[model samples]
Target: MKWLNKNRVLKVIFFALVVKPLVFIILGLNVRGKNNLPTKGPAIIAANHNSHLDTLVLMSLYPLSLLYKIRPVAAADYFLSNKYRAWFALNIIGIIPIERQRRVRKTELFSGCHTALDNDEILIIFPEGSRGQPEQISRIKKGLYHIVHDRKKTAIIPVLMHGLGKALPKGEALLVPFNCDVVIAPEMAEFQTADDFVKQLESCYQELKTYCITTTEQHN
Candidate 1:
């Protein structure tokens, strides 16, 4: 399927992004606490990966038109596994692929990312570089810092996806019907040092954990 068709994207979104969310809600899925989305300008979206579904779910959370503008940062190897991912990354998600093996692909991806910035696009990055449990957010790599440090112009927006880990946990292709929440917090200030950025990244997870707890408390 063509990932992005100016005319068809709206229709595709209707089915995939919109209808699915409504279905999710009918099945008891809803996003709570998106007051966290940055109000303006390009920002870095740093999130924890719990399942293969996390990225798509996150994209769905974005208001219809804005979804296409949010480019996902994905691994070249995985997203390029087939025509589907390649197109998904290129057209639908706008992924910047990084070579897992060496710096060659990394440099190319980094350069492409820089160009995306030139176009004023927001980027989504999974600091861990792969999927894992919500608790593993702290195990994040320094690549996040490298991206932010290089493009010091953008803000880093911390987002927490609640209930998604359980919705489609690793190794499961089927998405479990459940209520999901995407909590967004405002963009963070630039880090003073590389160490400081890592600290802040870890802190984002802590804050997300707090949000999850509070949400549970409210519902209970």
Candidate 2:
């Protein structure tokens, strides 16, 4: 039973594919731009983090089999433990441990990420190193830039989650029952050293934000 306590992937899969979608159906969760998702190999998706619900929404939109290839990079300190949630987080979704509190070799992460890209897998990255307050985003780190910059061959997609912050705020376990939006968009690419890289990166967030606003307007 020791190991059982550490493995929750099966349950998570059920929840993500079954229970959560059912919840969305019953509650009518709004998600758009799924067609923007690359249908084939080796891509990177960068998104903002607002709630635990963010991962579920993103993964659900990705095709089922590719779900197997998607690895979510999460904070090591928060998700690493002897507990079942920790085990599933580490083994199931393939966690990339990020030591935010300490200054570590940044290149190590890039090497691992590069290897994953070369393997033609999808990686989900939260640019905000730390989850921020409602309607707010933490300063995005360079990890995303480094990964996409180095692996130019891989498709890089920008995603934005809307209204999830109000549904579930930071530092709170209460997941309020409410509808949210997942805005998917086209692949954005630029040269590594291009001066427009910064604008391109910010453009991803801006597009997501715009999608959210437009969705809100349409619904109303």
Candidate 3:
């Protein structure tokens, strides 16, 4: 029960004892641009959504000591559908759940994300909004821009991932072991406008996705 309180100690222990092993050992990762991963917080990790593994793999990139500082931005409808799931997600996974269906102000929609960044925590956000087809990138959403438009100092790191969709696609719970690829871009430059920022982010995601696909073809 104590671990269900979002306890830092238990979090460290869980990532160390569980998540890391599952990510690295079972679902093997072939990571490129590992050095581009940020070591500190007040940062945003913008990645493509393919499977549930996307969040776990991104969080596992950080050190165990920094696990407490990692928050994955997830949808409230799916993750918080029930009390038990809400407890596990909030406590064990440490997600910032945002309501997708509620007609609320943009300020309220991302209040939790802003607070996390203000607290110097690293957020793992999927700009595609929700999971799409396996190994496919969807239209980049604008919520990512809203979270960072005012936070000038916050770093935005772009990451493109592949293979997880085939491993565990949306609407399925059974995970099939498959090698996954992660390509991380260096922290992106701050853009002056929301449109400019989202444009640059989308471009970056496309570039990474292309590189990943090309590299996979070469290996095969």
- Every candidate's lDDT: 0.67, 0.69, 0.86
Best by TM-score: 3
Residue by residue across 1-220, what tens digits does model 3's lDDT show?
6434646777788889988999999898889899999878899999999898899899898888678888999999999999999988998889999999999999999999999988898899999898977777788888898888877789999999988888888999898888888999999987988788878988888788765642323232
Clashes of each: 3, 2, 0
Order by TM-score, highest first: 3, 2, 1
lDDT of 1: 0.67
Clashing pairs in 3: none
Better of 1 and 2 by TM-score: 2
lDDT of 1 by residue, 1-220 (tens): 5546674475456547555565456334345457766534467788878666667766666666565567778888887889976875676566777777665654564776676667677778888778865334537787777766766568788777766666666777776676666667677776778788878877866776665632322231
Q: Using Cα atoms with residue i matched to residue i, what is each candidate's TM-score against the true structure? A: 0.80, 0.81, 0.90
Give candidate 2 regions above 4 Å deviation: 1-19, 213-220
Tens digits of per-residue lDDT, candidate 2, 79-176, equal 87558768767766666666666676767746667777777878788887666876666666667776676555788777877777766667888766
Worst 10 residues of 3 by lDDT: 211-220
